[model samples]
Target: MRIYGPNGTTLGAPTGNTRRAGASGFALPDAIATPETRAAATPKAAGNIDALLAMQGIEDPLERRKRSVQRGRGALDVLDDLKIGLLSGNFDASTVNRLRDAAASLKSTSGDPGLDAVLSEIELRVEVELAKAGQF
Candidate 1:
């Protein structure tokens, strides 16, 4: 417990305070920090290629992840192409809406940041390409 004056001046504090028992109930705070530090220092997700290969149930985790990433990138690229076609009056409203929904679904389901970055770079390239082609 701490004692304070009217202006929040520190008067005194009790050294032997057995306050909250719900705080892991450890005698010292450092006792609780060791396990937490170890947990945080290690990766939580199962990403080891060897571990994935040892699984009999999972045929190929790495291959599936790669394919999913590539598929997502392709979907985003197709959407970008459709958007450009719509802006150029080559595609109709329904085509534009379908491509937009496909892009949204890919964004929702994709777990790879690398693929997302690739998609962003591809969009930039498409814009530059369009300018060079005198479309914009």
Candidate 2:
């Protein structure tokens, strides 16, 4: 299985042929999705408009960042779920491609001036996140 970072970049394949650490010694696929493991996998935050628009109800700079990151997290989660469905015979090729295109567009048009200003710096991360959820 392919796991992606919060920004949507491929996080390399699961250590192929390697076993994950376990209580007794090691485990494989089953060990990968244990409740503890999943619980520990926190989603990363993205964007930072709240600070730029402090008068718009978002007072705390950190809170603004947290909200933006949460949004990104939601999009990534959607993408991951859709990816699974598509790979599992739920989506036809044409639909998949269409969704991919849509995702690309969303990624390009996040509509946040702060992000747009730093387009050079944030494009990759934005695209990756949006692409993951077909929100581009």
Candidate 3:
């Protein structure tokens, strides 16, 4: 059992003094650093610009075929439109302009001989139509 002092006498007094725990005799080794130290340790970034440019330069055969198909289809569609316009007696010069643009796109080779041959045939039809319209 314990007894307490008067409340007024112990009101502002501290409970006890604190002390650091003593070392246990075990110590950790210091870290060893490399002799070569960098003044500014900046991270190096990969050169993606060159890689992206190289990728852009590479042409895909499938993609080329697809583009050729689209161009051929587009030219045929324009020819159909021109025929409809002429038969309806409402022919427009803009149709001829679109035909001209299609003709330009059809000149590129698709790398596949079969596709190129088909595209050439379509190109010939476009030229004939252009000549008839006096826009060749």
Candidate 4:
């Protein structure tokens, strides 16, 4: 295969001529690690751990509600799939396994009473289905 250069010109053989530069005004800042800077930049392990613990303690109620809703929806979808599979006599063990997993995820409280109630209902349905499948 032949190579082509810009403007669709066929590439020719390379030449030996070369160019060199003498000087440039650019100068790098001193980046050497000194003891003073090292001490200043070093992170406090205790403070970092405390901050991480604090962050973990903070939970947004809306986010929790959203997560619970998603879990409920996933359980409903699996239930629908299970129903379809049963009706069609094409049931698979993996769908039962997924229903079990969805059941586990539904146990977390969403910090909202109505959402928690709905999720509880979904969880109950999942449990019923799992029981019928002999996997509970």
Query: What is the C-alpha local distance difference test score of each model?
Result: 0.53, 0.50, 0.81, 0.79
lDDT assessment of candidate 1: 0.53
Per-candidate clashes come to 0, 8, 0, 0
lDDT of 1 at 104: 46
In terms of lDDT, model 4 sits at 0.79
What TM-score does each of the candidates earn? 0.31, 0.30, 0.64, 0.63
TM-score of 2: 0.30
Cα RMSD to native, each candidate? 16.7, 25.0, 18.1, 14.3
CA lDDT of 122 in candidate 3? 91
Clashing pairs in model 2, backbone N/Cα/C closer than 3 A: 45-69, 46-69, 79-133, 102-136, 103-136, 105-136, 106-136, 107-136
* Candidate 3 off by > 4 Å: 1-45
Query: Which has the better lDDT: candidate 1, or candidate 2?
Result: 1
- Tens digits of per-residue lDDT for model 3 on 104-126? 99999999998899889999999
Descending-lDDT candidate ranking: 3, 4, 1, 2
Question: Residue 117 of model 2: what lDDT?
Answer: 46
Query: Counting only residues 3 or more apart in sequence or on different chains, how many pairs clash (N, Cα, C under 3 Å) in candidate 2?
Result: 8
- Scored by lDDT, the top model is 3
Q: Could you give candidate 2's per-residue lDDT for residues 1-136 as a string of tens digits?
A: 6556554435434535555685566455544553322335455556576765666763565665555555555545555655677679675454445445534443543345674444323435545644554643
The order of the candidates by TM-score, greatest first, is 3, 4, 1, 2
Stretches of candidate 1 off by over 4 Å are 1-59, 107-113, 116-136
